[model samples]
Target chain A: MAKQERAIRTRRAILEAAGAVFDEHGYMSTTIAMVLERAEVTKGALYFHFASKEALARAVLDEQVPFGAVPPQPCKLQEIVDMTFVVGQRLLYNSLLRGSVRLAVDQETPSGIDHGAPFRQWAQALTRLLELARDRGELLPTVKPSETVELLVGSFTGIQLMSRALTDRADLADRLAVMWAHILPSIAVPGLLPGLDARADRGARVLASLEERAAS
Target chain B: MAKQERAIRTRRAILEAAGAVFDEHGYMSTTIAMVLERAEVTKGALYFHFASKEALARAVLDEQVPFGAVPPQPCKLQEIVDMTFVVGQRLLYNSLLRGSVRLAVDQETPSGIDHGAPFRQWAQALTRLLELARDRGELLPTVKPSETVELLVGSFTGIQLMSRALTDRADLADRLAVMWAHILPSIAVPGLLPGLDARADRGARVLASLEERAAS
Candidate 1:
């Protein structure tokens, strides 16, 4: 059991180190040697976990799409909004997610890496939630679920990219708040629009909730 | 005059070849030799115009922001919509524009090249037009020009990226049509919303008009 726990910890460390390198240098410029030096793992251990740099990047890319920690909101639209904020906040500190975004957005990988998976996954997640919101009458009557979700996903992607470029995402939550404010007028039902929590630190509350849940 | 024209033609050919290569291989993977071979120019001739691959890419990046070919419309919002479609059409066939977009969005640059310029230029252009839109009383009272323009530019950037990834951007105009449909109702007064020409072939007409004007 001790050995198994050690192996898991090593894997986590490697991923963290790889994520930092990949996020910083992007895919082609990053080397396994850098990851190893940062991770402080033996070459054999690194090889045991990942076959190639491509494989390692693909693994990091996969690690980012899961935002399981944000507690569910009563409104499906709020859940979607919370997910973007938590993600925006997380991108400020989470190397894994940051690397995943770099890979997803700007990195030109070899043909083997699936760049579209994250986009499709985000679309699917948002589409499912949008449909739920639609059914609950939380959406404006004219809000087409698929179209609205695409705008949200695409806008959020570019907003974060611009925020990252301009301010290192120090203003990501504020930018997201502005984004929700502009979009919600066209999306959420009139009553729900006033109640939507899209403040700058909403992500902090969500993360605190996650910590509380874990502690309990 | 003959010597000057020949030099101009050589520069155009080199830029085109470089743009195609950079768009396909991205910045880091692109080599000077590849550009020389594709441009069919001697290495000395290539270097005479562009000092390095980075210089060549920066030139391609600069070439993309010119939407001057798009004729202006009386309605500032219509002008913005028309410009996006024309750009969408141009991107399908223009290597320089495509390379510009690739450089602007992806690729690991050596920090000498400015990736944020295009985003800033786009934001500024759209902001100017949106304010004009407001002056004409064409916009909804709630539309905040800067916020709305940011959402538009960012959404357009990500929408084009997603379209390129999913369908090689064959459906870019259609995707953009849907985008304007989702956004205009929120931005434009009700009367202007129905008259917005966001069809896929709108770009073709704009191009055809440019051709006619040039011929005349």
Candidate 2:
């Protein structure tokens, strides 16, 4: 195998290992040796990819937003709904996303790390989509993109935390469904509510659709 | 002061100092000596009341809800709104409340602590009030007390965290106002929306009214 390919695989493995460790022990309690043991890599290999535990945590915290296409819908609201469910579903299986979320909301972060960046990023992403929905005349007249985005992002943060605390996020998709049901009334036009596919199984369906798209 | 009175005041002082320290450094990084220095009490005095740092943190985490009464409003929905805002406003001023909130949501808690207790307590508190609102016909016909309570508590959790991250909670009351405005349209009957005192200054007013009632 080419060295570049091998190096890329090793880096991914390290990040994956680091994410799980951070999620379990948090930043302050997590040690470099624990990450190295998990990754099954020597200290040299770990150092080559990252400088310290803080750097590793920084890298992990940056992976909350995964890059995969959710099949778009005619209604921008549907698209935003899919985006949130997809994330909700991903959090159930993805260590990197889980680690990032834990770090983002965790009271403790390593010095110099911008722990709040993910919240701001989620806010921006939701804002863009909400603005699109507004332009397409899908939103209610009282809908403010900025205010709703803050609520959406913040509520998502809190909803997921509650689900995790109560049920270990096994009900995250359902919780997201409940959130959308409560919020969509104030957000989307009354005409659009019945058609929006906000449901507990949305994340599973969205993921399956993505797989089908990839296979096709 | 009498011996019992002096002891009670000292205990309050130690808890207060420990709360601020925990708020600043989080659970793991906080040291007993740091709390002792802040409380301005001797190590022996501190130990006489609290056995360990975990014990001290547990004590602080128990104080998120302060024992002040918001004047009774005719609408139960109005009461819930005032409750959230009052906590929001207090979060900006009270060290014990602030520390409890931080510890409640912190990633790195000390060994053998129940960090999730506060979330459950908040959920139960809101659920009861929401149930009352439903019984009195203040809520919309379609409102589900169970579902709405989860969203309300969860959203408040996320909203305050967001406000704190974005503005150090300086705008928390206004954010709570925004939250209620959006949520009320769905939960409360249309007739009640026009009369609900869900505003930024609701907390200040509720607190001041409590003061006036005490004076009278």
Which structure among the candidates has the greatest DockQ? 2
lDDT of each residue in B1-216, candidate 1, tens digit only: 699999999999999999899889899889999999999999999999999888998888777668535787898889988988898899889987888888887737655788777777887888988899999999989888988777777777788887776677887888787777777777889999778898878888899999999999
lDDT of 2 by residue, B1-216 (tens): 999999999999999999898888888788998998999999999999999988888888777655324667788888888889888878888887878888877767743787777777777777887899999999889888888888887888888887877777887888888788788888888988888888799999898888898999
TM-score of 2: 0.92
Off by over 4 Å in 1: A1-3, A212-216
Listed for each candidate, the true contacts retained, as a fraction, are 0.48, 0.65
Tens digits of lDDT, candidate 1, A141-164: 888898777777777777888777
What lDDT does the true structure give each of the candidates? 0.83, 0.84
On a 0 to 1 DockQ scale, where is model 2? 0.68
- Interface-residue RMSD per candidate? 1.9, 1.3
Q: How is the predicted docking of candidate 1 categorized under the CAPRI scheme?
A: medium
DockQ (Cα-based) for each candidate: 0.54, 0.68
Give per-candidate clash totals.
Answer: 0, 0
Q: Could you tell me which residue pairs clash in candidate 2?
A: none
